[model samples]
Target chain A: MEREVNAYKCRKCGTLHYPFRMVCKNCRANDYFEFDIEPLPKRGKLLTFTFIHNLPAQFEVARLGLGIVELENGIRVTGQVDIEDPTLGMDVVGNVEVVRHDTYDDRYGFVFRAA
Target chain B: MRDVYIIGIGITTFTRLEYPLSEIAAYASMGALKDAGVTDVDYVLVANMGSARINNQSALASAVVDTLSLTPAGAVRIENGPASGASAIKEGFMAVASGMHDTVLVVGAERMREVNNLEATDFVATLTHPMAEYIYGVTLPGHAAMFTRLYMEKYGVTERHLAMVGVKNQNNAMLNKDAHLHQKITMDGILDSPEAFTNNPWVAEPIRFFDCCPVSDGGAALILASKEVAEASGKPMIRITGIGQATDTLAVHERPEPTDLMAVRIAAQRAYEMAGITAADIDVAELHDAFTILEIAESEEVGFFEKGTGHLALERGETAIDGKMPINPSGGLKGKGHPVGATGVAQVHEIVVQLRGDAGERQVKDARTGLACNFGGFGNNVVVSTYARED
Candidate 1:
């Protein structure tokens, strides 16, 4: 599993976007630079969450918790959360791990855990 | 622009039908042609999504037109995610309005049940952002769950409110023979009973099984004609008074405020302006309710109520069939079923039926002006249309 996630920052407007964008939405600039984010903080707050019982065939888990976590950088990203009971605004921290494995390869993604 | 009117409309029952995709479209088209008492049209527009991927079929318009024996007429397909139906209707409206075609036939169909539920879910997930949302396995219900969570925190909308919408629409569907869900669901059976948890499990957090629309297979068709052609048919004049469409960012996180549906607002505003009317003037409306929360959010976004107060209107029974201003009287996507591409045209079909006083038990009394909102891609692409009966 990758230890850190990658993001792109638009050089002109200082907008940080994950999964990258060619043009800056704010300033319409085409300049950007890629950088690996430091390990997510040990603690963050959950914006909202859902317990997904019905999942795609690729994910073997019977049920999974998915939520949007607001990192200290104020960037919100959708990730799987490892929590038995999750409440809005609950503190969570990023845990880089293998989320699933398909016929091809093991897939790694972020799963937030209660601090 | 010349005035356009709906000469006829037809829809198939929204359920699993073991038929070819082209056959579904052809069936609905034939019904509409018979309703209009016309054997030929100047053009044909087919609205479909996932035909190539799920059904392994392309050139859907040509197949449908040929099957309907409407060959030699200009035919094309429209794919706009889930909003394809309304988009094609808008195109038909333009064709008639611009004098390009005196009569146009618009048909929306989808055979999503060709695949299993899992494959169907994954196929629909393609509408999400490839890298940001889809990569992390985000589905429509997941997005709606988060959106519902935020809406609840901001507006005090509880689970009861969501259940209310589900029960209301599902019950309303009892009166609609063509609706997909025939089993009547009540708050007690699906919500308050001891077996409720098992009866309605969570598909995504905050969004339960009942909160979602069934993946349906169906088709709906409408006949659009210029005023002269429509008048000659001796049918009730249901004029296409307004059309408005707007788009938003491909990714949901990019929006300045994730909670605000700007596309819906802009599209509805433009439609109202073009129609020379306001929200208060609508006697009935068919807002896309793929998720129960959407009916509430769209009601406010379309100016039916103030922001954060749509649930209040629901609490007051104002959105019921007998309410002051009825919404989703045809049971909406919740009960009527959502065949993706067919949903938008089905919405129009329901509104036209209501406006014509042919909606039977579900008819909105004294209905004259109606509105239809066809939402696509989680509020990214929205189409709002207004219709009025000319006495």
Candidate 2:
């Protein structure tokens, strides 16, 4: 499962919490009791973006490429933009890739790319 | 509601010092005790936004208590991003007003310099969306800059307008002996200096290094007690008549207007309600100017002026210490230094000083009632406090 996107489902309230959550914010269900959910919508609109001249040494290769996007479903996420010309309300899509040095071996992380 | 008063406040120099965080906190605690003319205290509230990131430790409450040698009493640590200081004061005020303790010491300290700049930025970024913002790499200055651009585009504000905020606060800092940066910088100096790497180098567009607050290592403490205890302590009593707090979405983009901080509005409304006064009743204020634009925006958000009028307020000297409402007399975060968790407490400390007619050169004449507004993480969390002299 190198460089693959993952899903998270809230055990209580059935509200899916992507990435992960200590407990469902919607429901104070302490026991995570993990389960699978549909992959997050790939397409989104760029709510805002920033150009980082400085970044962590490990993320140097991805310099000036990070931003946050609001999915059509209104789920906001941060990821790397594949191209320049980033603007507010610009449409983008998700991509799964090995970001290098994943905390979990053989795992890929979700990143954003220009649609 | 029982009457509660903030008797005295003390703060260490805000600078890039090498002193241990514990020592800095102790000095502030002792200074506050001395200022209030008290020795023993019932409760101690510590506020530190992120010692886990700075020192990789979380025993901040125990550290302050042990350093001050105040034992067997209630002690707790409060964490509310940059508003940690104000949040701790809220807790201390409630505890004493509720008759839980007669005297309480509230110390807010942060040793941000312990970590390098990048690490500190990263740690602060954690206050943003963990998986959405930080994991993808977003710094707070970056967010503020975006909002700055939007605010300018909509409100027709300019860099010159933003620069005035730095200029005024820097001038105020010059009068503050313990300020982190006290040099009086002209708008031209800020724009023309090649050495001003962060000042103009552009950490994020619209928010230069000069616009942002310093990553400082310092501490501030306040002594609070019931009105009776304050009377017995022989210190000038600055009553906490109104205290209000509110929250907004953690993510900046989720806010109704990236430029507008509604959290401040909500807190201010509640504070005014609690105090039974309007914004017009305020004699002076110490705002959370973590960034220069924040001072402008927060001033408006808290009803000091109409929306989109904050920039003009700065230009017309309405925010000057001698103006209609003196803002940031202690130099603000821009010049005084933003020691994260200590900022909110420092705001209260400055208000208490001004209210007591003890602010010396920076004092606002005929000061009676003082207000402080401290916000955390782009107004995600906010605390507004109002203080009045017993006179």
Candidate 3:
């Protein structure tokens, strides 16, 4: 077992949302900011990915792999891809780890690998 | 609503400039004012994205107004990421259309070249979701490249099709004197030949250097006037017939169908409805091709072609300057240069040039009606417009 990234579920509609928002998208007929914290399932399938050779100034790498992954719980999230040869629809498991190293500190995000 | 007409237009060369951001905007504003034969405007709207962050300049509209000696005029800068140009014009359109102002000057300018390549890339990357995408170091190219992978598989599109778009837009740019990157690139050199790897290296896999628009520094201006003021200006009556805008999920991965540009579709439909016309009625167009694939993808999204069939239209030579319904004759953002703030206004500038039959060698034949698509962010925020020659 490892540390988990959280997804907020609407208390009213039971809809799941990541990178939480002010209002619930599915059903807003309930109290504001009423959401349940749920641990996101890490096992998923790779959707689409790219190996970016042109990177931002912050990333200290010749190239970086990034992708959108569909989690086992049906939540899709963008994460760093560490897989050597990631094909679309391939099984992947995510781990919460440091994805960026800023001047101040390291930023934690999902990093995916072949399951 | 009162009729709003484009009485005058102006633009600076789409290339690196050694001028200040305010000066660049003022320079274009002066050109537009002189074109309209007016010394003063009722209101001023400046469209800029990175003036403060990249150029270390803030209150851009105030700076430009004072620099042009247009003091005491109410002004503000409209920033909508890459769609700032069209968004400013949209505001200017409202000002005049609502009878609040008789004449409004809208200018879109940016000096992204003021910073180093790394900083500029990060600046543009700010459009993505910070917690979800940016923390993953997800740049715009990376986002587009991932979307392109889905497109290639779902629609049977290939690298050759992507290269064709790059070839057409870049070559079309040579005809535009104001466009950046005047160098001629061929398919053999960029895609087919052994030296292709050296010539068009990957910026993001599936997207080569040629596929992405160059980081440009430039400005474009437009003068929107009420019918009475426009009649006095004596320019070809180019009426603003339609304006439509829509937004989707800010994060690209959040959308149910990742490759589907729902905002583009919805925005264009609204625009067409406002103009009382359909896609087939458009004689010419300027689509936001920040990346080559966008031109193809947006064509379908905007109803010019069926979904996933835009590439087929490209293969049929239907999107060329001489082909049926020519798109991006001014080289689009791909060739013309994409100064984030200026791109939307520059798109309209080209369309107006076409509708007025003043586009010279790049003009679409009998272009009585034209459309411009100003895309913001990664298909999240979009503004689509329709323009017509009204005698």
Top-scoring candidate (DockQ): 3
Tens-place lDDT per residue, model 2, B52-112, is 7678778788888987888876789899899899999999989987887889999999999
List fnat, each candidate: 0.54, 0.31, 0.93
Q: Write the per-residue lDDT of candidate 1 for residues B1-391, one digit (tens) a residue.
A: 9999999899999999899999999888888888998999999999998999999999899999999989899999999999999999999999999999999999999999999998999899899976556756778998899899999999999999999999999999999999999889989988899999799988887889999999999999999999999999998999998999999987776676778999999999999999999988999999999999999999999999999999999999999999987999999999999999899999999998999999999989999999999999999999999999996
> How would you class the docking of model 1?
medium
In candidate 1 the C-alpha lDDT for residue A102 amounts to 53
Model 1 chain B weakest lDDT span, ten residues long: B129-138
Q: Model 2, B256: alpha-carbon shift in Å?
A: 4.2
- Taken over the whole model, the C-alpha lDDT of each candidate is 0.89, 0.81, 0.91
The residue-level lDDT of candidate 3 at B69 comes to 90
Q: TM-score of chain A, model 1? A: 0.83
Which run of 10 residues does model 2 chain B get worst, by summed lDDT? B192-201
Question: Once superposed on the true structure, which residue ranges of model 1 sit more than 4 Å away at CA?
Answer: A30-43, A100-107
Lowest-scoring 10 consecutive residues by lDDT in candidate 3 chain A? A27-36
- Give per-residue CA lDDT, model 3, range A1-115, as digits (tens): 6777889998888899987776788987457669888989989999999999977777889999999999998899999999888899999999999899988998988999999
Q: Is candidate 1 or candidate 2 better by TM-score?
A: 1
Distance from true location, Cα of B132 in model 2, Å: 1.6
DockQ of 2: 0.34
User: Which candidate has the highest TM-score of all?
Assistant: 3
